[model samples]
Target: MYSICRRIIFLETVAGVPGMVAAMTRHLHSLRRMRRDYGWIHTLLEEAENERMHLLTALHLKRPGPFFRACVILGQGIFVNFFILSYLISPRFCHRFVGYLEEEAVITYTKCLNQIDRGYLPMWAKMDAPDIARTYWQLKPDAKMRDVILAIRADEAHHRLVNHTLASINPEQKNPYKPGE
Candidate 1:
């Protein structure tokens, strides 16, 4: 349980990076070309915000100490730079990478949910869903931790599909989610 929670915390910290990097690079690209980004800017920025909420939710569950916080800072610094460079070089590859990360997040959250269901984590036995999660997802007041996990998993799945679809589309094509002509 400790290990699982630790992994979730660390992963969530890194999880928010790609979307932010993508949004930043895309925004700069759009500015340089003096054209709209279609809808990628908003979508990517929203993705970053959602991932930050996930990190916030997880932090409510587990508060790591200074050492772990330092690790998270270092890791995120490295990852942000790497992802920024990667996106600049090949946006499609960056999208594919984020898609894969979201896929892994879904799997990890599922395993966490399974552990909670199996009575392995006593702390999670009757955990209330965080208010931030409920508000972000607009869940009922009665929603529990498991419900929040499910919601997060669904978000990851959606992100995975969106990123993968983006990766496969031609760069010259307009954004897939753009307003209709």
Candidate 2:
């Protein structure tokens, strides 16, 4: 249980990066070019926020040690710079990369859910969703960890779809999905 939570916490930290970098890049480009970003910024910002929520939710389950924290700081530093440079070079490639990562997130969360259901993660199988998870996902007050995992998986699927869709279109094109969609 701790292992899975730790992995998820770390992954979410990294996963939140692209959206922020992409959004900021687009915003700056728009301002420089004297045009709007169509509707991508809102969605990208939302994606970043959602991933932050996921990280917060996982942290509620398990706090990392100092060594793990150091690793996160270093990893985030490297990933943020990599994403900034990558997005500047090719936004489409960055979005596609994020889509691929989201696919892995879905798979990891599914595996965690399966482990819980199979009685391997007994602690999580019996635990209730954290209040933050319940509020963010709008889950039942009595929702369990399984319920939270399901919500996260659904979110990951949505992000995968959105990123792939974004990758297929031109950066200046109007975003097909509306803000908060």
Q: Please give the CA lDDT of all the candidate structures.
A: 0.85, 0.92
Candidate 1 per-residue lDDT over residues 98-173, each given as its tens digit: 8998999999888888988998876776888889989989999988888888988998998898789889987656
Ten residues in sequence with the least summed lDDT for candidate 1:
172-181
**Candidate 2: what lDDT?**
0.92
- My TM-score estimates for the predictions, one after another, are 0.93, 0.98
- TM-score top scorer: 2
- Which pairs clash inside model 2? none
For model 1, what is the alpha-carbon lDDT of residue 149? 88
How many clashes in each candidate?
Answer: 0, 0
Query: RMSD to native for every prediction?
Result: 2.3, 0.7
